[model samples]
Target: MIDAIKTFLVKIKDQGHVLPLIHQADIQVNLHCDQQIIQLNIKNGGILFLQNLDGQQVKYEISGSPTAMKQLFEGTERLRVLEQQGQLKASTPLRTTLLLESIFFLTKAQNS
Candidate 1:
């Protein structure tokens, strides 16, 4: 499923019309696990920091644009809403905090 999602995102980005969405954005996804923060060097400088709280693991995936990513962390209840709305699906206590660190990264990073 991850592979499928990646392929789809890549295709969407390759389309000239959609590419403009993040022409100046970059993203980095940092997975804080194993007692360390794993940093991913996004090619376009886009960064996504995902901190999954212990005891929770998601079954489905929650996806959005860079702007939407930053907004999801406004409060704790918002996370719950995402799950309930089928945006984020997890069986454990997975808490996520998203941060936008650069303007060169976009969905292109993950999609590519």
Candidate 2:
């Protein structure tokens, strides 16, 4: 799952617009799915996944069931919709939400 997230982030970073958007972002985000918790360190226009949750202070938090998380990453579900349905909750600032929205735009599925 962590590998999938890393791939997602890397794919987002490789997109044309994301580099400028995340150029100077230094943020730590904690994602909780099922019983697993991991910290994603964003810096230098890239993300690093840290599995150790020992003493990290996460600036943003998103928690949900594993299935919901998979749906989100697969672009089958939006975070806002999941939150509205009580399947997911996120503790994030407005700026972080905007940043993530932009990043996730790269991963959203296209309708043909």
Candidate 3:
């Protein structure tokens, strides 16, 4: 899953759209699925995926149940809608939240 996500991000980045959406901000974000957390660290126009928290500071964290997470990853349910309905919890400023949402939405692997 992590390798797939890395590939997805790389593909998205190579397509030339992801970086502009980020607008050159270095950020660390987390997506929590059940008891697992996947960290996305964006720095110097590159992205890294980490499966452990390791106490690193996270700029944003979005969490949901495993089913809800599947929905998000599959694009069956949008993050904004889930967040609005309290199906998912997020910690970050609205701008950052939106950024994270867009990033996730764009990098979702097909048939994932």
Candidate 4:
């Protein structure tokens, strides 16, 4: 599951537009899927999987069931839709949420 998330992030990182957005972003994000928690450190246009933050600050957190997370990674479901349906929760402001949504949307578009 973490591998899949890393793959998705890599795809986003490879995008021309995403490089600029992420290059300036030094963010720690946690993806909570049921009892499992995966931490991602996004910095300098790269993503790193962390076993633990080691007291590092987290900028965002997203929680959802495994199924919902899978759907999101597969681009079969939109983040906003899942959040609206109460299937997922994202702890971020609207601007950041939209930025995430756009990044995912752009990756999906590139694949298509």
TM-score to true structure, per model: 0.31, 0.79, 0.74, 0.77
How much is 23 displaced in model 4, in angstroms? 2.0
- By TM-score, the better pick of 1 and 4 is 4
Model 2 per-residue lDDT tens digits across residues 51-70: 86787776699898887776
Ordered by TM-score, highest first, the candidates read 2, 4, 3, 1
Pick the winner on TM-score between candidates 1 and 3: 3
- The predicted structure with the larger lDDT, 1 or 3, is 3
The CA lDDT at 104 in model 2 is 58
- Count of backbone clashes for each model? 23, 0, 0, 0
> 11 in model 3: Cα distance from truth in Å?
3.9
RMSD of 1: 11.4
Runs off by more than 4 Å, candidate 4: 52-59, 109-112
**Residue 105 lDDT in model 1?**
30
Give the winner by TM-score: 1 or 2. 2
Candidate 2 has what TM-score?
A: 0.79
CA RMSD for every model? 11.4, 2.7, 2.8, 2.7
**Can you tell me which runs of candidate 3 are displaced by over 4 Å?**
1-7, 74-76
lDDT of 1 by residue, 4-97 (tens): 2344345444555444544554433442322443333334423233343454443333454333333332222344455466554333324222
CA lDDT of every candidate = 0.36, 0.72, 0.71, 0.73
Task: Write the residue-wise lDDT of candidate 3 on 7-112 in tens digits.
Answer: 5665665546667776686888798876778987777767777876687767688887766665565445677888888888888788877776776677664544
Candidate 4 residue 11 Cα shift, in angstroms, is 2.7
How do the candidates rank by lDDT, highest first?
4, 2, 3, 1
